[model samples]
Target chain A: MDDNLMNKLAILAEGAKYDVSCSSSGVERLNNGKGIGNARGWGICHTWSADGRCVSLLKLLMTNSCVYDCSYCVNRLSNDVPRASMSPEEIAMLTMEFYRRNYIEGLFLSSAIEKTPDDTMEKMYRTLDLLRNVHQYNGYIHIKAIPGASSDLIRNCGYLADRMSVNIELPSRESLKLLAPQKSFEKIMPPIENIRNNILLYKDERKSFKKTPKFVPGGQSTQVIIGATPDTDRSILSVSEKLYSDYGLKRVYYSAYMPVNEGPNLPSLFSAPPLLREHRLYQADWLLRFYDFSVKELFAGNSSSIDSNLDPKLNWALNNLHLFPVEINKAPLEMLIRVPGIGHISASRIIRERRVNFLDFERLKKTGCVFLKAKYFVTCKGKYDGESLDSEFIRRKLLNKMDYQQISFLG
Target chain B: MMDYLYDGTFEGLLTCLYYNFAKIKATGIYRTDTYQTSLVNPHVAITTKEQLADKMYEKIRKHLGTYTLTDLYYCFLSEKDGFENILLSFIDLCFRNGPVYAGYHTHKEVIPFDDIVGKVKREVQRYVGYVRFKAVGDVLYSEINPEFFILPMLASHFADRYFNEKIIIHDAGRSLALISKDGKHFIMPYTETDLPGSEKEDHITNLWKEYFQHIAIEGRINLKLQRNFVPLKYRKDLVEFSKPK
Candidate 1:
């Protein structure tokens, strides 16, 4: 490659590194035989970063030059950082080159508002158009939906991209106004809601036609910058709950606020990022999506913040001591999944495996349950392990067994 | 007590099971290659008969569905120590209870077989993600040193993914290779010298290595997480971990 292209790539990739949404799953598009690449149902992580995040796509920005000056962004317009912008053709060529080398699954193109939101969005749309129509690249492409861009431009970009995201960087409208004055939830929520309605509409169209082009088949996701503002966990999750219920979002990403720029509105550089809180929110999100958990169940009586020592599921189990000692052999599938030690897959396995025989402790252990943690709350063959139903002792025992400080990237 | 022994092929195992089921009152069954020799007990070598193996397999498929039988076959592929005895006992239970034993997860005899099958399936699934292909000339070549005999299991996956290109997946651990061309694939006994690196292969490999090193975040360096995802055992064949040729 030429020196100009290389310089642009280095700056653009570095600028896009902290977005933390490089996933390439939830859509399976077969290569049209003429196309160069295909998207698998389960996304392939070509490699991992040193931080252990999966690098599935060539995640990069179209340009770092911006018109809006967000306080938390590295590519804020007022910053003195080096700025470079790739033309739509240059970005398309780079994606094809990287993809052919098997360096990435596809493209994750996000950009700062260079001239205006519509101007920046049109540049991104042209990049996607060239990749899809001109280059015939049929791989996974995730693009950012510029919050203030026109509905027509957003709809056009949604047609060509596999997934679209509009980041709710700050939790509340007040935070958006105070820090990111140019952006607001009014501008952000409209585009997200539009994509959701269009995706549903396109699904209905394709049911009869059978050849209609997919409109954001992977669905839309939004990211919230946690710990940047004074928003509580309850408030954050409530927004997520509303997003899921009203907008039908596929995912809501939580990014622990990594201090990037210094401003009076932003958090101090000395404070650590809330990595543990982000992880707990993800665990809670999984519960909502797969484990049939309601938002009210988590914050029903006293707590809004997730317990740091135990996982969200275990924490909930310990607090509701009246619901303990659930019978493993006879508990329904929904109740079984609510158990701390039994995950979605294992709970299903238990349901499947228990049909033919009466389940005992050994059988439950063999079914992939976290047998040690589960022994306290579950009874097999009417026999429980703990001497008493003392919640504090059980909590302490679990804490002694698990080191909550050590976080797994699997979460 | 009598001991029945046979070669370690699946057919050999089936033949041994057949003999114990029909001809002999054997106390224990063993694969002759893996079992230690002992002068205390009398051991008889059982020759594999294709017809008898076929009959035993038919009986198994009749008692349990093909899904359960495939699970048992995967357990056999695991090649772990004393897996033959476990298979024999599992098959015996299948015959006695006529499908209840296979369905019942809590049965003492069924749990060990379930464990082995689960282990084999997990290894197979991991290799699906862990297998990395290096471009050598027109063929996309990858070499794996998987713990299980998983080359056969990986045939349909790679074939579907790379339908237009010729591909070869070599299992270096077992000296086996599954080669596909024109959308068709099959496995054969392979040696080290079968694959010849293309001229530009080194350049592409270096490019991949460059991308791998630069992609990791400097602020959040977690070797523990990296090791957890790409285990040290399978890193030998991975392009990021391997030294350039």
Candidate 2:
């Protein structure tokens, strides 16, 4: 209610708005009758921001006084912006108040590395401690793991938070050196590796024992700044694939870099954020995670960029035309999922629905399959709608459909 | 042609289904109001028989999986015109074909029923996000005018979530309220009454509006995408859309 606190809240929240990693809770924790809040597995989006992104958490920074000057960051030390810091108690109080009013699912506590990485992380840890122990709030909390924070500090905070993330802002080590002189892959990668090992260890222990006090039960994630330092989609997706495969990360967020802070290294102030590119990357990322796609298969014959005209699945399907014309009723689950416009849910539906009776084109439509693009690739009981097997024919039809439905200028 | 007429409730629909299964040939099952003007078919007024409804519900669970039972409930909740008849035909198909009916997405009888169920469930999911509660006296109150009668579906989620608080979630369109007090919850017909919001509620709401406006990045302002998620129909009661008094 204090005037000072309101200004601080505005400054801190504005600093934290660029983050896109707080959409889902991913952990389901029921209230133990005493706690003030409960975490649902599929997190609730309390409201959609004007930018059309979900505002699930009270995303705020502990302080906007940074020691490091990342080129893309609005809160870099060199930038002349209003600075503010909240006490751990103030943060906990604010989170509980917002949560009680149902304005937010929980807190997404990040910081500007005010004094040092460890110092900033410690303050965040204390805030989480205050929320959990002092306030008895058990909502979905996602806190940032400061890149250079010590393992012990990261471990201590992991116990209280549902999910933790360390943003790998730059795609490659070379880009990190060029744009963000202070950060390196070496500093960021270790905390992620440590969290993964501890999560695995805790999982094993919890299986044997009942009350292990869940350590980052929602798992860990990271973000990459797209369009910042000329990193190719291949380079970006390669890092994402590595994070998922090696570190066991739950998600890798792609933030279309907004040119907030201008520098020789950063994009021009007027250059549009590569939102469509970011969207395509997300589509490709989902393929990598869910559609059994490998980085090698995605960009065969040394292509680095994703197709601008088509989605990753359709692009891949067009390139591998020999594999298409898959019989809907007879095709296996893996093959069905690989087909363009057949998502995991619809693929499963097709598989289940076909066992009782043979699927026709009309039946496949009922299962929510994208018939426009899918008709070209799939044969329902040897009946194919697409006239030609030529890849150009299918591609042209899809492009025409995309033309009518394009929402943005990029399309 | 024989037409079955029943009160527009899930149990009433199920009771009609029971008679249809017991050698009563149904050209269609319509709500009593819907069947009143129909000229071609002879109407049978089906009473709310709890035993018959229970038997049909159990038979549905046994023949089809629990998923179909859920779909049946959702389809009934959809309240779309002719949805009851679609449910009857879908159930009849399931009864004849056994569990295989679930996999027959291509079947003429099954598609409409599944689509309605999906539509209703989708709306139920949206209401979970769209329902905004305001502090009113000792309890929180939220009112929704959703297309579907989602009060029964929304009740369990809100009860588990705000377990401690006494909350009233009113479906203004359906004139029903799912009220929770001391962890116990039930749904009943509710007429609109003036429930005064707390004095602090408006102040807190304004702060939230400020946060909402500030959070949106200036570079990305897509009204089409925002509207797709939070449609205009549901925006009337949401705090962010409300003009300050």
Computed on C-alphas against the true complex, the DockQ of each candidate is 0.32, 0.59
What is the per-residue lDDT of model 2 for residues B126-215, given as tens digits with 9 covering 90 to 100?
887778888887788888899988888987777777778888888887788999875679998998658886657765676677777778
- What does the lDDT read for residue A211 in candidate 1? 86
Clashes of 2: 1
Q: Where in model 1 is the C-alpha error above 4 Å? A: A2-7, A29-32, A87-103, A129-138, A400-411, B1-63, B98-108, B192-207, B243-245
TM-score of 1: 0.88
lDDT of 2 by residue, A313-365 (tens): 98898889999899998989999999998999999988888778788888788
- Error at B146, model 2, angstroms: 1.6
Q: Which stretches of candidate 2 lie over 4 Å from their true place?
A: A407-411, B33-38
TM-score of structure candidate 2: 0.95
